[model samples]
Target: MMTDALTLLRTRKSPKVFDLAAPGPSPTELDQILAIASRVPDHGKLAPWRFIVFEGDGRARAGEIIAGVFVNDNPEADADRVAIERNRLMHAPLVVAVVSRADAHAKVPEWEQTLSGGAAATLVVLAAHALGYAATWLTQWYSYDPRVRAGLGLGEGERIIGFVHVGTLARPQEDRPRPPLADIVTRF
Candidate 1:
């Protein structure tokens, strides 16, 4: 099992587009996925990340919230521009909003807590991949928007790490360029 997992990790590729025509994980499967995703090395035992699920009609509502904010900010944007924001989450059947609720008052460094949130996001993607589904961690413009944050029910100090879109792949995934180990790694 360990060898298989390592092989999967080595070859896992993020698909560019998810198949909207196919079904996503069911509620039970998604619960399992989320459970696996939260098993990260969180220093100080601070589980600083929370997951928000968007599926079915919720995706459309969430998209409307994002597009509403976008249109308000960019009043001159055309219909196509507004539609792009409205359909942002349509790429996949399920979307998970990874919210970073890192507390500054914790004994752990805020940076570490924030990093734990990021790890949770990464794990969501990996867990989806291991489940025979494709996922991509995306932080589009809406993620940084204050109104969108409020619409998503995030607290003042909470921030979005990224949104993980998960579903079957619509097409083949292309392997992107990877840097050489020597260029990106160093031995002490």
Candidate 2:
């Protein structure tokens, strides 16, 4: 595993459909995953991110919070759709919310700080995959809703980078389409 850096980089994929019944990273394992996540490049060493983990009952609590706000936002949404909101965090055994605490600072630009937070979120997905777990990073409408942000204790300047859902896969995810480097990249 240590020697397969290129292979792992080329093959890592995020899986959204996870095995809810399967156990997620143990406490120790999760700690390690977070440790790896914290290793992202940070301009000015601002460390502009923090993690909020939702596991077990925490997932349900978060779901309820988001679901209530969802119901309020989409009053026309039927019971089924509302119910889907309640299960958002339950799709995985563990969900981690990467919070971006980017703010105006002397040395580091807010954009760079925000990018560091995003890098931390990506690192989380990669760390989970390396630990034999599947993960997906998602931020839907609820992510930007002020009510949901209030429920997450987000401050005025703080924002959610994304939610990384981690667990075992219910079924193998086939590789999907990839963009051609020739089309997306150009030499300076």
Top lDDT hit? 2
In candidate 1, which residue pairs clash? none
Residue 143 displacement in candidate 1 (angstroms): 0.7
TM-score of 1: 0.95
Q: Would you list the C-alpha lDDT of every candidate in the order shown? A: 0.87, 0.88
- Superposition TM-score, candidate 2 onto the true structure: 0.94
Q: Please identify model 1 stretches exceeding 4 Å from their true place.
A: 18-21
Give the Å shift of residue 33 in candidate 1: 0.9
Which window of ten consecutive residues has the lowest lDDT sum in model 2? Answer: 14-23
| lDDT tens digits, residue span 130-164, model 1 | 88888888897889988899998999999999998
